[model samples]
Target chain A: MNALLEISGLTKRFGGLTALSDVSFGASEGAITGLIGPNGAGKTTCFNLITGTLPATSGTIRFRGQDIGGLSPHKVVEHGLARTFQAATTFPAATVRENILRGALLRHPLGLGAMVFGGAAARDAERKARQTVDEVMEALDLTEHAHREAGTLAYGHQKRLGVAIGLATRPGLLLLDEPAAGLNPDEVDRFATMLKEIRTRFGLSVLIVEHHMRLIMRICDHIVVLDHGEKIAEGAPEAVRDDPKVIEAYLGADHAK
Target chain B: MSMSATSSAPAFQPMTVVWIAGIVLAALIPWFTGSVFHFHIAIMVCISAMATGGLAVIAWVGQLSLAHAAFAGIGAYTSVLLVTRLDVPVLLGLPAGALVAGAVAFIIGAPLLRLRGVYFVLITFALNELFRLIMLDIPEFSGGSSGIAGIPKISLFGVTLSNYQSVYPFALFCLALVMGLLVLIRRGQLGRRFAAVEENLALAESSGIPTAKTQTIAFTIGSAIAGFSGAFLAHYVGFISPETFGFQLSVSYVIMLVTGGRLALWGPLVGALFLTPLPEFLRGAVEYQHVIYGVVLIAVLRFLPRGLAGLPRQLSRKGGRG
Candidate 1:
């Protein structure tokens, strides 16, 4: 399958320290790719680079065969590549519905004149946006809590809201940084099911960075392992999991047992 | 849970009904007052309300700007120049001032909006100083420190608005227009984006909101409104001066906005109404007038962090619990 997102020779350096060194990876279209690594492995940094929140030191990031290496975050989103941070970042002061509407508005922007005049075009855009918001809320099971402030949501629901925000972008490629990070075991299982359901429904590619091995292993079609900013293994989940380097990277050399 | 979501109040309410009654009373003020002094104070309040309205709009987008009065100055100078030098009518020239101010704001804001928080505030403060210096240095056009005098009275369709009676209605109309524009903006999608950007920039950007553009839009609109107010000030007083629009004026506008409530729709209106005539009311305590003003402001801010607009909510909550 053709890759929806392709990161090649991606490197990020912080003065003297190199955070991501010549990392290369690809997530195929409509596939759930898991990027798993220990702490200080540059997983979040890589996500930031691809999402255009952080500048890359070197290399190219191709989304749908177009080089989008240096676009601004919003422009990157405009190109149909969206991401959620490791921490669930929602507009705390806004309600869940409003937060989702913000994302929906990206698809159909209301210009300043339209905003002031409120004619048929603006009304149509708003109606479409509200519909999109409703659909997204229902898909993420956030309908009941739609009117509540996003900051007041439970930890698990906040994570779901983060995913819902990304979904509202209607992205061709969704980058989720630890969507299952603070989720409980049952919630993690449910999240994996949700990811699969979303994939089947939307037919969009997902690149997830998660420390939850059970969730990642269960849901990911392919797995990539990174250690100290370098790619260590990449293949089918079983192949990468059984790789000696992956075992050594996680357990350390002495604990190869 | 530090975030305080705005109350989900329905579109129409008892408060709006009260606002309409207040407007009616304001319109009838000229009939009751024979003295020009009373009309002058009322006009001052209207202009201050419009200027503070602009400040409130910028604050809505999560920025505090000290250059608002400078924008007013731009409007005053531009409109005055167009009317005196180029023979443009007051109606065309007034809006022209706002447009010029908005244009300058858009240009400056594009680059400056990138600076967040205190740095943004500092840059805008510098901008206010820059505008003041430009006005003082360009005496050839701005009339220097003494300022331009004998600004012609507004003549609309052969009805010369020369007296307090004539000017009061126009001033009231302008204030109404500013208030209406602000209310419309607050109730729109654009306003949602502004709040979202203020609440969380990273999240707002990831949600594909062009945060920079939103900031710029807010700043530009605020500047235009201030310019609109300033243009009215020029015509009402029949004079224009560098001293008229300065950092102190901007600070006063800020006080109005802060005292009114940062997030509430009517915050600035309450602030302008209360504070504009405060000095006149404090004439008996002239020696300690500013001191009294200081104390009152501090007390209000310390007790009512949401400004005077939040008073009703606070009172209701207190009553409910008590």
Candidate 2:
């Protein structure tokens, strides 16, 4: 399968600590890719680098043949790459529908003059945005909470709203950071189903950073394991699970024996 | 399944009618009493409201600008110079002031906005002081400490608005234009972008909204409005100096905005309406004027944190609970 997102030799360093180093992976078009590791294994840092939240120390992140390593976050989004945060980041005061509408409008931003004058183009864009918002909310099962302030929604609903926001941007690649971090087992299962449905429905690729082994193993077509800021194993879910390097990384050196 | 989809249609609310009626009554006050003082007060209210309305725009993007009055000063001087030096029409000078102020804001906003929260406010405060000092240095164009006096009155289509009564109507017309522009912006896509940027910068950027550009746009538009208001004030009051658009003036605009509603579309206007005539009403207790303002501000911040424009909503919410 063709790579929707391709990263190679990616590295990120703080003042004295290397958060991610020489890490490389590809999320294939229309496939669910998983990035898993122990805590502080640099999974989130990898997402940050790909999404342009932080500049790569040294690397190339090519999305659809365009280099997007150091682009601003919004510029990255303009290239059809969007992301959801680990903590369900949202415009807390805005309603869920409004939050999604904000993302939807990004696909069809009216000129400032057109926006103020209420032209036909502006009206058309507004209609399209409303439709996208409605569809995203329905897909995420958040239609019932559409009018509630995003911050006021239940934890699981807020997480779903985060994905809905990412989906509304019409991205070719969606990066989810710790999406199942706090979800209960049942909720995680529901989320797993929703992820698969959206993959087919939206025709988009997903790169999910997760700690839940079951969800990753069940849904991901490919799994890449990282340990101490380096890729330790890469393969199909079962093969990666059986890899001794990944086992040592997850369960420590003694457990691998 | 689409809850409140039809809520987009304009719904008749009793509070909306009440607000309109109250504004109409206030607009007719000078005419009813035939008081020149009342007309003067009304005109000042219009100017204050218009300037504060500009500050409200900057506030919407989640930045507090202490240099707002400096932008107004930039506008005031630009208009005064154009009218006096080149024989430009006062009508043309107004928009010229706005253009220059907006241009200045566009130039400075990118660097200035890099600083957030109190740092942004502090830098703007220094900029305001810098503006006053720079103008003071150029006494020839700025008229220095004593300032320019006996400026031309506002004239539209060769008819001068020579008295407070005539200027009051013109001021009202200008205020209406500014307020109309605010409404148009608030109801549009740009408004949503502004709200998103204000609410969460990181989320807005990640969602494909250009947060920096959105903030600069708000700053430019807001400063332009301030410029126009400053020009109008220069012509109406017939005197201006660096002192006129000083820190005190900027603080007053901030007070009006915070007291009115930082986020409400009508906050600036409501704030100006409630605060402008307050000093006049406290004529006998002149020494206590600022103290009263302090008390009112504290009361509003505590009780109606959304400011005066949010009063109806607050009252209704309380009533709902009962």
Candidate 3:
């Protein structure tokens, strides 16, 4: 399958500290790719660069065969790439439905003039947006909590809401940042199953940044490991799990030996 | 189950009727009292509310601007010059003022909005002062400190509103138009976008909302409204001066916005209604008028953090629990 997202020679530096160094990977269309790394392994940095949350020091990020590097976050999303935050980021005060609606509206965005002087087109767009929001919420099991404020949600639900928001954007490629970070074992299992279900249902390509090895290993079709901002290993989950480089990165070199 | 609440349809509530009645009664106050002074005060409220409405738009995007008064001044000057010099009709001049003010906001907003929070406020404050000094320097247009006097009154189709009563209705009409526009915007998709950007800029951006552009749009609309109100004030008051739209004017607008509910659509109107006639009532203690204003502002901030417009919501939330 052709790659939905391609990153080559990606590098990010914060003055003296290099956050990501010449890391490169491609997420295939209709497949789940896991980016696993230890704390400070530059996994989040990769997500940020891919989503245009931060400017890359040097690299090219291609989405759907077009260069999207250095574009604004909104513009990157407009290119059919959307991302969820490490934390369950949302419009805290807005209801779950409202939060998802904001994301869904991106699909049927009305111009300032069109919004102010609304017509049939605007109404149609809004109707379509609401439909998308309903579908997204239902798929994410957030339909029941639609009226609840996102900030007031339970921790696991909030994480699911984050994914719901990303899905609402109708993205071809979805990047999730540590989605299962704080979930309990049962929640993680459910989340993993949901991820797999959504991947096939939506026909989406996913690049997930996660430290939860079991969850990542269970769901990811392919895995890439990063250590000290560099790609240490890349292959199927089983191969990457046994890679000495990945083991050393997760555990210390002494522990690995 | 449906997201119909996100749509613009007004859900039936008893409070809605009470609000409409209150507004209608307030609008008819001048006629009820049969007093020219009441008419004048009512007219001032309309203009102040309109300007404050503009400020509220900027506030909606979670940015407080001290340059609001400057935009108003830009409008005032633009309208005054257009009418006095080029012989443009007052009706046309009003919108001209809005256009110029909005244009200025659009130009500066891209760079200016980059500075968030207090820094944005400080820069805007400096911009307001700069506007005053520069206008003062250009006495040929601004009439120096003494200012322009005997400006023409608002004339529609060659009918000059020569009296306070006539002008009051016209001002009310203009206020209604401005408020209507505000309502249209608030009920539309742009309002949702504004809410998203306001609630969380980062999330909004990632959600494919162009936050910077959204903010600039809000600023432009807000400043344009300020401009229209400033133009109206110039024509009705029949004077133009650099000091008219100064730091004090901006601060008063902020106070009104904060006192009413920074994020509420009716905040500006509520603030203007409550505050404009206040000094008139406190005429006995004229010297302590601002001190009283300060106290009221502080008390409101302390208790009604969402401002007066949010009072209903706060009370209802409390009621629901109790």
Candidate 4:
């Protein structure tokens, strides 16, 4: 029905450096769409622009047909678009469960019932969060480490927790920057499966940036390649894989430049 | 396993009887001791601790506010004005001053809160200077540099507190009230969201926790508590001076929170108690007390990054992270 997220001719710049130069793309509901590029190709910058973490230099970002440009990051989430950062972002002092609960609790405006007493609302919210945490952990196979301090997790798990926290928001559009960045091969395979589960189970539409080509090629329904801040390729995975521009961007950088 | 929880709420359980024992010990200190002067200093410590606990919210959320003392000044002056000009009962002034402080914090914090990181810090520093200058101009209201005088004592439920003699326990009561609020916030979702914003603002925002709004709400609440403390302190002294609410007072607040542990509810109290007694303890060498305090702070900052209550936990976390 509704195309989940629509970004048209979006441009963002940092001082003189044009980080995202008129990049345009769309991701539909229930599809795993990938944004792939070499380092400094502005994948994360595009993400920042979409999530409203960074103001777009110019152009429109419409989430389910609503213009979401210039809103602060929290407002972006409120509008049903959520994102996972490239950095290992977690409340280091908190347990994995508390981290997820914080995300779940953010859905409410007043947080009235939960804020006051050890009242029913607070307990209900917490129980729901605990259930979601358990389900997400099961899906990600991180159940055993539920009570562990988030900072103590291996890098890959911490990265997944960032995504889990985002998933807890139950966003209509989930933008993930480099979800598979530092994972080993086995972990990447596991994460690809997790991504598929996230999409299917949550009915989520995803826009992901991953430098890990194998994971992208395996799980993505479609792929878009960016070269020097421009969308160089976008198509079904097979066609995009054989793309000469994608090839040059990834493999033949020096000569192509 | 926390040792400072005062309440019995299961979900937000703090350490119970142990903390009560500690509070009981604190209550006996003034009665058991000889010097009224030391008791006065201890009372100051309690008041300052309560105010700094409020300031901790601002500091912990990465907002450095040098205008805490100024907000307290607003509270103190408001209390004085209400008592002197309006002839309001002194008890009315406490809540009135607190409400004004909260209102002022909201007004000032709303605009300046758009400034992040060190910009927030600088704006607050300038705000302290501005507030002092404003006090200077409004001589009719604040009594200028000479400040307000003959401000009456707080009469709680019809019992008029005598300055110095009776105010020790009243000041201590104010300290308890402020800390109790702090403990509630610290154990709740608001506190968690605040900490989340500090850890990763972008992540917090993406998670739909309005980071800036959270900071502003915290600032408002914190400033309100500071005002409440200010109201009590002003009446306790029976006088108010702009100098008492200057930038140095802000630093003193900062020093207390920083030394105790900005993250912990008790950190501000510990910092105040530790530093408040140092001048008296060194007595004849009062001049060197602050110098040594400065050196000690440097040493702690270098070695104990998270303040005293947090040190052992930090080490254990480092071990676990490794």
Interface RMSD of each: 5.0, 1.7, 1.5, 4.7
Q: Clash number for every model?
A: 0, 0, 0, 2
The sequence of per-residue lDDT tens digits that candidate 3 reaches over residues A50-167 is: 9898999998999999999999999999999999988879899889988998899898977778898788888889788888888888888998898898999998999899899889
The candidates, ranked best first by DockQ, are: 3, 2, 4, 1
Tens digits of per-residue lDDT, candidate 1, A87-165, equal 8788887889888888988888877888776678777886777777777788788888988999999989998998999
- Give the better candidate number (3 or 4) by lDDT: 3
How accurate locally is residue B186 in candidate 3, as Cα lDDT from 0 to 100? 83
RMSD of each: 3.5, 2.1, 1.9, 3.7
Candidate 1 vs candidate 4: which has greater TM-score?
1
How should the candidates be ordered by TM-score, best one leading? 3, 2, 1, 4
Off by over 4 Å in 2: A253-257, B1-14, B284-289
- Poorly placed runs, candidate 1 (over 4 Å): A253-257, B1-9, B23-30, B33-35, B284-293
lDDT (0-100) at residue B39 of candidate 2? 97
In angstroms, give how far residue B99 of model 2 lies from its true place. Answer: 0.8
Q: DockQ of every model listed?
A: 0.50, 0.70, 0.75, 0.53
Compute the lDDT of residue A61 as modeled in candidate 2: 97
- Write the residue-wise lDDT of candidate 2 on A1-257 in tens digits: 58989899999999889999898889999999999999899999898888888988998999998999899999999999999999978899998988998999889978889877778999889788889888888888988787788888889888899899999999999999989989999999999999999899999899999999999999999999988899999999999999988887777854656
What does candidate 1's lDDT look like per residue over B209-276, in tens digits? Answer: 88898899999999999999999899878998998888878888888888888878888888888787
TM-score of each prediction: 0.93, 0.96, 0.97, 0.92
RMSD of 4: 3.7
